[model samples]
Target: MPIMFGRTIKRPPWRQCKVGSRDDLQVGQALNNKVMELQEQDFNFTIDTAFTKEIRVERLPKGFKMPTIEQYGGTIDPEAHLESFKFVMLFRGASRRHHVPSIPLYLEGLAKSTEWFECLKPRSVSSFVQLGRAFIANFMSSRVDRKIMANLLAIRQRSNETLRAFLTRLNSEALKVWDLDPIVKFQALRSGIRDVELKKSMIMDEPADMHNLFSRCEKHINLVEVLAAKQEKEREPEKKN
Candidate 1:
C-alpha cells in the first residue's frame, strides 16, 4: 500500500521556448495562461487589418440593452421626469453600459416619449456627452430650485386633497428646497396640514418643537391614509355589483 501511494505534481512550462532571459519564461507563461482564460470567457481575438500579422487584444462582451421610452413615460412633470432620468442612469451604471452609445440611446428614448425634449433630439446632437449636457440645460431647469423654495414657503393644503396627499407633496418639494430655516419650514409645513382634529390635538399637547410635532403627526396621517385606502378598496367590489 505504501509503495502504491503517490502525490500529483504541477509544473510550469519551461522547455517550450528559448528562454533567453530568466524573466522571459515567467512572462510568457503568464501571457499564455491569461490568453487561455480570455478564450474560456469567450473574448474575441481579431487580426489587426492595418497590420495583417498583429493580433488584437480580446474584446469585452457588450451586455447593455437599451431601454424603451414606453417603459417610462414623458417629461410632463419636471420632478417626475428627473426621477425617471436618474433611474435610467442608475440602470445603465449597473449594466456597465459605455457612455458613448448610452447618450444617444437616452436621447432616442426621450424623443420617443415626447417632442418636448427637442434640444435632446438625436438629429441635433453630434457628440454624445454634449447631448447629455444640453438635456440637463433644457429639462432640468436651474430655476427649479428657486421655484421649489418659493413653493415650500407658500404651500397650503388644498381643500379637495387628503392630508396624506398634501403632506406627501410638501415633503417631496421640501427635500429639494435647500437651506430653509428649520423653524420657518416647520411652521409652513404645519400650516399646510389640513387635518383639523390632528392640529387641535397638537395644539393641546404643545410639543417642544417641529421634530416632535412631525413624529406625532406622521403616525396619525399614515393611519388615516391606510384606513381611507382600505375603505376605498372595499367599496370598489360593491360598485362592481
Candidate 2:
C-alpha cells in the first residue's frame, strides 16, 4: 500500500456542542458519552466524518517545508526535524555522534531505533505512527543516520562491500525512493556531507538488515562489546599488584 501523509481529521458534523475538559477524556467511555451529548445538543452540524469527507494523505515531497506555527496563530510550536537529529547526537554524546554507520546485522529501519531508546520506543498506535513518520522524514532529508540505515540495508543484501560503499548505494536508492535526481545522491555522497565510508562497492547492490544503524557523529564507535570494553579500559591498569 502507498504511504499516506498529513494528519487525518474527520470534521464532526453536528451543531456546536459543549466538550468537557481534558479530564473528561480520561474516563473509559467519556468520549462516547461526550459525542452522544454533542449530537443530542446539535444534531444538524454533527456528522460522521468517515461518511462526509474522504481525506487522503500522500507522501511528502523532498525538502518539503511546513509552515511555522506563526502561520497558525499558535503559541506552541513543533520541534524542527533537525532538532531531533541533534537530540540523538547529544544523547549519545559528542564523541559518539560522528561515527560511521554501524547497524546490527539484523533489524529493519525502525525496530533498531525503537529497540535502543526508551524515549524513541513505540508502544502505541500513535507512537508507532509518530516514529515511522520521523524515520521516513529523516531518511528523506539525508540525516547521517541515513548512512546507518543504509549499512543495515546493505548487509541484508549480503553484498561484499563495506558500509561506506553501501551508504553510497543507499543514498542513490533514497533519491529513487523520493523521486529525486539520481545525481543528487552521488553529489551529496561525494561532497562528504552525506558521505559514509570511503570504500568502493566490492559487490553489486543487494538486500541488507538496515535497522538501528544510524549515526551522524563524525567520530567512530565500536558496535562490538563497546560497553564492557570501555569499562575494562576505565579500570586502573588492572591494579597491577
Candidate 3:
C-alpha cells in the first residue's frame, strides 16, 4: 500500500529550479519606477500648459510712436488723454502689433513735470490703466484748482469783446473746470452775457439745459453775424453804384 502510494505520488509536475537572480526581482520594481517617471513627466507637462495659459506673451510693435498728453494739445482732460492713448494702442493692433511692452512706453508718454511722473519714479508699475488714472488725477487737479475754477465762475464778457469773442473766452475758461453742475454752469454763462436782448429772452424762457442754451445762443450769434455781413455787402454795392 505504501509503495503504491509512493508511486501514486507522481513526481511533481515540474522541477523547481531558480532561473533568475535577485536582480531579476528588481525588474518589476524598475518597471514601476518607469511608470512613476512617466507620471512625473506628464505632471510637469500639465503644469507648463497651465502656466502658459495664464501668462500672455505680448510682442511689441516695430517703430511704434508713444503718445503724450501734450502731443494731443496739452489737454488737462483725463478722458481725452486716456482716449488718445487707447486710440494709439488700437492702431498698433490694427497694424498687427498686438502685444507690446507697455510700462516703459507709458512712462515715456507722461510729462516729466507732472506729479504722476514724480510719484511713480520709484515704483514698479504693472498696468498702464492704473498709471493712466494716476496721471489723470494729477493733471486734472492742476486744471481744476480752486483758484482756477473760481476764476472761471467769475468771468465776465469784456466790454471791448464781441459776442463771439466773449463766448470763446468763456468757453475756454469753463472747459478747464469740467465738473461743475450743469445748472451752475448755465447760470454762470448766462450771467456773463452783455446782450440785454439775449438776457431777457433767457430769463423769460429758460432752455432745458446748458446744451440747449449753448445751441440757441450760438444760432442767435451766427444769425447776427450773418445780418451784419449782409448789411456790409449791401452798403458796398450801394457805394459802388
Number of the predicted model whose TM-score against the real structure is largest = 3
Where does model 1 exceed 4 Å of error?
A: 1-62, 65-83, 91-97, 107-130, 136-146, 157-187, 191-215, 218-241
- Comparing 1 and 2 on TM-score, the stronger one: 1
Per-residue lDDT for 192 in model 1? 73
Writing each residue's lDDT as its tens digit, candidate 3 over 15-61 gives: 23234755555665787898666544524322112122212254445
List lDDT for all candidates, in order: 0.55, 0.34, 0.59
Q: Model 2 — TM-score against the truth?
A: 0.16
Question: Across residues 39-102, which tens digit of lDDT does each residue of candidate 2 receive?
Answer: 4442322212111111112223355433221211112121233344434434544222121111
Q: Where does candidate 3 have its weakest 10-residue lDDT segment?
A: 45-54
Q: Provide TM-scores for the models.
A: 0.37, 0.16, 0.46
- Poorest stretch of ten by lDDT in candidate 1: 46-55
| Pairs that collide, model 3 | 59-99
Ranking by lDDT, best first? 3, 1, 2
| Pick by lDDT: 1 or 3, better one | 3
The whole-model C-alpha lDDT of candidate 3 against the native structure comes to 0.59
List per-candidate RMSD values in Å.
Answer: 18.4, 22.7, 21.2
